[model samples]
Target: MSAGDLPDPAEMTDQLLDEDTVRQVLTEGTLEISGRLTDASNLTLLAVSSLDGVELECVYKPIRGERPLWDFPDGTLAHREVAARRIAEYAQWDCVPLTIMRGGPYGNGMVQRWIEQPDDSPDLVDLVPAKKIPRGWLPIMRAVDTGGADVAVVHADEDKLKLLAGFDVVVNNADRKGSHILTTAAGGVLGVDHGLCFHTDDKLRTVLWGWAGESLPDSVVEGLARLATGMAGDLRLEMDEYLTVTEIDTLARRIDYLQMSPLYPMPPRGRSAIPWPPL
Candidate 1:
């Protein structure tokens, strides 16, 4: 029988999907099935029709795991859902379109807007040839080229840095790998993978180095301060139903850090060194 025909977790085991379809989507430790979900968990995948009339992909986490690498606890699926909603609400920006959908192979997974791009794209990590940069300061150079400095350097867009900072705060993201960032032909940069976010830790990690140990722009600093000061009220009114108090508090702390010290310390090299995780 196909895996799709199998019974859901809460149902009898005899109702499981047929083996053939499960194998079809399973390759190299990844599964690619397409169907209307009947139930979902953190590891489950759901396919839904998009506003554009095309089916899209989404992941659902009904339970958390143990000792999660990021701040999130294991088996904390509800927390992830709340965090996603909180980010979408706090940012007041549609950077991520988090939707609730039903009728999938697994069940109901939070359907996030999908970004289309080539499998191999130039990522910020590529800017550094070796694990350690020779000059220990190439990001500033790239930023300058992308208009991160006096002018837009990479994509000739000055506002990119600001948006990046905003995303970091909204998600309380601990890791911001180059792969997590998607660049569009229109010069837009998008961020993804917020599962490891909204934790009360100083876990900000990223590939951008231009602003490290440097004074932050007044505009960005001010924006962080504004968010920090109004987080409690804003979050309560906007995301209270979805997010927990702890999650909101963690987001507030991240904003506070940005406001208090815009320029964070650089990561130390050597034995304690590890490449940023692909978030």
Candidate 2:
């Protein structure tokens, strides 16, 4: 969808200053504004309370140069809008409606669906106990694995995983880190961060690796096959209007590989895995 299709920020004027709202600033020069919809970013998150009450989280170019790493230009809300729309369409998943909100006390920002944190939240990255090693990845895989018996060793909600995988494939997600997967109190898992996604490269960098060399579950394989066959048609059509032709082609290749090699090995460490916002 184009910028013209997005909701206008002027329409949300009064709600933006609600008293019940809370705002917290996050690292990497992001500000979390609660209560109303605001700007768009490479990554934007908002938590909608009731129907009208909304909380927003936005990641944008850092205003200050204290750390000396931030470099992207400010006021690029249009780029994020395109990425979010393409991802939501390709995966058929719901995304927080995004819009260009006023900048923070610092730089430009974006508003997105703000997800409420679960009451019983685990440390986002430290959930996998040290002893679990690669085994911890099993449960996450099972929750998302779609292949079959030889490949599917654990049990998890398959439908959710399929959607998540589809989102990854569609966005060309380069980073599926542990922290980015949020587990809600309602026992739902949500994926975030699409800024570094949709790149025209093999950019799948995830921490879940237990099923590295194992055959994929039948269901997972089937999902990949479906995506592969429909990619050039339905999926591409959905993304074409929002994404570049090259970006869509990369997504198609990833789906094809997933279908052709049910047990595709993970990319070797150091070869593809790099730190986010690489220094």
Candidate 3:
């Protein structure tokens, strides 16, 4: 959808703010720090933005709170998170929520629309008994559990997931654990915590490799084409604000390669293909 045609809040299932209103709240509203997500590697804050009686829930990851990574430049993760959302928007996939880089209570950071997942939302990626992989789930790997029982790493065989997998390939996402995939009450899929994405190298660690070696769906190819078209024009300029020139060039190259091959990439050789603590 175009910037003017933001998807309805109802489609987001739990969000009461429309896209424009949410963006307004994130950009110009009063931010109130409510809590912290302790499990987050960075100092992630749970916050609410209020504007003229409209309140929106959001996650704030301050740049100063970011933990330095040996690979990614310090303080750049927040920018990368915003860039990931831009890429998704360019691809017309809507796989990521509205994300922006702005000043928060702590400091400059990435602010994103908080997704409220319904309790009954289905699991997209999961660990199940090896012998009983769900009917429509594709197994990525098998391992012996701590109890010595065989278990499998699997994800649902759904188009939304396939689209996300394609998105990860383009971004070279270095972390795509099961927990990163959020299923909304509307049954829409949203991916979060993208600080590990958009690297220039082949650090594509993820658990959504269920479709490895499979042909890319026609819709996915169309999305890639859209991204490519953007890369050649405004998208490159936009991403330049966040990623290095080499990184943006590498992303363009990945899009081109995928279009030529039109298949899901195989797990890279000589590397751990999945993230630790897969969920």
Instruction: Identify the leading candidate in terms of TM-score.
Output: 3
Q: For candidate 2, lDDT tens digit of each residue in 173-236? A: 6666655656555555566554556667566665444354666656556656656656757766
TM-score, structure 1 vs. true: 0.58
Clashing pairs in 3: none
Return the TM-score for each candidate structure. 0.58, 0.53, 0.94
Task: For each candidate in turn, give its C-alpha RMSD to the true structure in angstroms.
Answer: 12.2, 10.6, 3.4
Backbone clashes per model, in order? 44, 18, 0
What would the per-residue lDDT of candidate 1 be over residues 1-279, giving only the tens digit for each residue? Answer: 443443343442211323232222221112235543343213544333322112234443333222344445654444555455455545454344343322333443334444456555444434432234544234332222243433211221245644564566446566566566676444556665555666665555555544546666565565555566567575555555545677666667766776767764565453222223322
Model 3 lDDT tens row, 1-279:
233444444454325556766787678878999999999999999999766555678999999999999999999999999999999988888799999999978999999989988888888898999999989899988999999999999999999888899888889899999999998877899999899998887999999998899998877899999988999999999998999999999999999899899998999989999999899
User: Which portions of model 3 miss their true places by more than 4 Å?
Assistant: 1-16
- The whole-model lDDT of each prediction reads 0.47, 0.45, 0.89
In candidate 1, residue 19 scores what lDDT?
29
Greater TM-score among 2 and 3 belongs to 3
